[model samples]
Target chain A: MEYLLDGFADGLMRVLRADPQVMLAAWVTIKVGFWATILASLIGLPVGFLLAMGRFRGRGFAITLLQTSLGLPTVVIGLLAYGFLSRRGPLGFADLLFTPSAIVIGLVVLAVPLVAVFSMTSVASVDERVRETALTLGASNGLVAWTVLREARFGMMAAVLAAFGRVSSEVGIAMMLGGNIEGYTRTLTTAIALESMKGEFGFGIALGVVLLAIIFVTNLLSRYIQRS
Target chain B: MEVFFLDNVKFRFETDLVLDIERVTVSSGEVVLLTGANGSGKTTLLRVMAGLLTPEGGVIRYKGEPIIFGKPGLEHRRKVTLLAQEPYLFRGNVLLNVSYGPRARGMNISQANEEAEEAIIKTRCEGLIHRDAAKLSGGEKKRVALARALAAGAETLLLDEPISHLDEENSKLIVEIIKELAASGITLVVSTHIPEWASTLSVKNVRLAYGRVV
Candidate 1:
């Protein structure tokens, strides 16, 4: 108990002193989460809009599949990504496995379905009257889509923010694909896991605090954006 | 002279069948009235004519060639405008909403602003130029919606019960605006049942009935 107390005190002091490892982990987590989210949003947002707007023979079925995929396991995604980056897999030659890039790939995969699921509901909920109004006004399809998307932006941002939260806090994929390499693949969550395992309770507890702070900031920002 | 024709049209919504019509035609520069009790296919028929809904069975020919749907539908869309029964001002100021279409079509900022100013004047909404469109009153929102339509250069105005929720005076003003738009060579298809007001416009009338009830 005394050792645990001592570690906690040490971790607090380290945080107060601007420890390099603590800052580096936080920075890497932000970078990986941001880039992966952006890529996922670019792909997921338009695909979601198309899913909501365009009709096909099996759209209901496809939507069901997409919605189901939103609950996909992070470990499974990591494993699947691991295969692609492994020596025997398709892109094995690039030697990307167990690296930050691999971690980004995992995060992107994990974020896509999440972003799509929310954006789909957001886009679909747009009033048909607005669309009819835009159409009647001679606005093109692109313009109409833009209008609908704009109207649903608050909801869509919530979805994107949720994806960011998922990736930021997830441990399984980052540990598996990123390998938690020091000064490179190390992230807030992975560092927490690693420090906790090494019995460095103070550092892990400090990271946990930082993680909570990031989540709070993200939540506040998304809510603010939605309200505006 | 017919800008559009909807013939042998039939539309159904899931278990509720909505529209069944043999033939209808609207010539250019004519203000038309679509009226019936609520649940009549007035809105549905307008949707079909505007090419928003595909009739289960019908031919909608615009300009002699059977109108097909595509990005080209946007071209016709640019020519016709529809106003919904409710006012839903988009997020932005009045000036932004009025100029949104031109900007989307790649109009220069200056040109879009100029056109938007002209539309605000035309819709008599110049007073609300800088106000938040999303915060406007029912009558003001409708007029702003009209200004948006006007800015897009739409010549055919399709209004769905424009006065459904307006005060008596505001409703009367909207009716007067419809008459003026008709006189200015813009086609107006307004859906309403106030015969007192309907009689005042130089308009052709069309009535809607439900698929089964009537």
Candidate 2:
């Protein structure tokens, strides 16, 4: 056990010294996670607001569908995205298979429902009079929607943070869709998996520590926002 | 000089008829008091006039021009404002809440702040300008909301039970402010259960029962 601890300490020192391989993997993880979160927010914020506020048929069903999708398996998403982006597929012309863009697309699919459902729930929880008051104060329809969004901004931010956390830690989509290519698509989770399989437990533990730190910071930020 | 004219207006919610008024006209710069018991449709009438709720069937005119339900243009909407019994303030300081209307209407921040500060001063809430609007007392929130409506420069103001939960001092201050706004040629439609407000403003009283003018 002491030997293991010593190896972990040594591995952490190497990581602290900024190993190029680990740094490259961290960069890819950050880029893929941020882009996926951005795409998800762009698609989710408006749809979620409409789901919460618009009077329409099938709104309940749409919300239920999105809510049910929150627990979707990462591997299933990876496989599905792989099918769509693989050679001879309808979108094969893009040649995006095993690329960071493919990983981003898969992660976005996983994140959109999370951001959407949370945003809808948050917007729905806003005070009923907020819309009426804004409208009565001479705000246009667009402005009323903006007001609702502003009121729910914190919840929406939490949703974004949650999406980033999920995609950044997910290994299935990164391994399958990203192909975990060295210096290109390799991410923290996939590198950890590879290092562990190769009996490099110390290096894997170091990566695991970094991943845990990221999750901790994300959760901390989310909790702070919720409290404020 | 008429501000609003409603003829044959009918509003239904689900299967129940809520409001059915044959005719009511509000002239410019007049204080019209709306008094009715609970569920008597006084609030519904104010809401319809504010363009927040659409009448199922009606011929409504604003300044002698036909005003369509659900599509009252921004300019027309800017000319009218409503204050519910319990008003809602956005998540911000008093200054931000008061400046919302002008900012929503595309006014620059500096100009909107100027108008908002002026309204806050007029409503006697200048001391609370930097305070969190959501944490204010009932009377202060109402006053801030009224100041927001004032900042909009609305020609017509519809207030529903503005002083319902206020103390005597606050109530008197609001009444004086309303009187001053009326004196400035702004049409006021105030709904309340208190008889003193109508008498205090010396306004014409219009009563409603079962959605009909009495």
Candidate 3:
């Protein structure tokens, strides 16, 4: 108990002092999370819109596949990305293993389904009258779609924030793909795992606090957007 | 000159026939009233006329030219506008709602604003220009929606239950606006369940019973 208390106090102090190693890990986490979420959103939003509004063959199958992927374990993603990015694998020529890019690639795979399914729910919630209203008012098909998306903006933003939270706090992809290299590819989750195992409890606790803070801020932002 | 002509039109909601109009014609600058009971296909017919719904089997001609339902129907749709029974105001200020039609028609901001202001004044919504459209009262929403339709500069307007659910004063105000619109030579097709409301206007009455004109 005394050791835990001491570690907590030391971690609080390190957080307040802005320790460089902790800050670097937090920065890497933010960068990887942001880029992965952006790429995921860019791909997922349109796919989601199509899923919700478009009438096409096999659409139900596609949506069910996406929903099934939402429960996919992160380690599986890490393993698949590893297989593709390893030197002897199919994409081996890219030489991307153990790099931040590899971590982002793995995280993107992890986040896309989450973003897409949430976006689909958000857009589908918009009233059907919105489309008819736009069409009756002379808006082209593209403009009508834009209007519907505008109405669903807040929910879509929540989807993006959810993706950010998922990727930022995940450990498996960062561990397997980034290899938790010091300074270059280390992230908050990876650092927490390594530091705690090495008995650097203060460092691990500090990173945990940072991670919690990030998630709290994201949730607050989501609530604010929803209320707006 | 005929503005709209429908022959052998049929529409169904998953095999439950909603509209089966044998023939109907609306002339240019005419005020046509569609009166029917609930579930009598008044709204469905209005939607079909607005080009928002394609009839299952029919021929629809606008100004003597046949209207194709897909990409080719856009031009005809632009020339006609429909106001829903429960109007949906876009997420923005009243000005934005009013300006949406003109903006969608490719007018510049200033030009759209000018058209919007004109319609707003006509609809007696000048004071609500900056107010959020979603927060308006039911009557206010209907007026703003009508103003939006007016600003589109369409040749024809179709209003579904425009005065339904409003207080007597608001209903009278809408009737006055309808008269004004009719006098201005804009083609109008208005649907309502109350026959007494249509008695006040000099309009061609097209009564419907189970989707058939009676």
Best model per TM-score:
3
**If you superpose only chain B onto the true chain B, what TM-score does each candidate give?**
0.92, 0.96, 0.97
Global lDDT of each model?
A: 0.82, 0.88, 0.91
Candidates arranged by DockQ, highest first: 3, 2, 1
- Per-model DockQ against the true two-chain complex: 0.53, 0.63, 0.77
Model 1 C-alpha lDDT versus the unseen true structure: 0.82
lDDT of 3 by residue, A35-70 (tens): 999999999888898898899999999999999999
Error of 3 at A182 (Å): 1.7
Give the runs in model 2 whose Cα sits over 4 Å from its true position: A1-21, A56-61, B71-73
Clash statistics: count for each candidate:
3, 0, 0
Off by over 4 Å in 3: B70-72
lDDT of 1 by residue, A1-228 (tens): 898788878878877897889989988899899989998999888878889998888888888888888888999998999999999999899999988889999999989988987899989998776676666666677778788888899989988898898889988899999999988999999999999999889999788777878888999988898788
Q: Model 2 chain B, poorest ten-residue lDDT window?
A: B67-76
TM-score of each: 0.88, 0.90, 0.96
Cα error, residue B21 of model 3, in Å, equals 2.1
Indicate which candidate wins on DockQ. 3
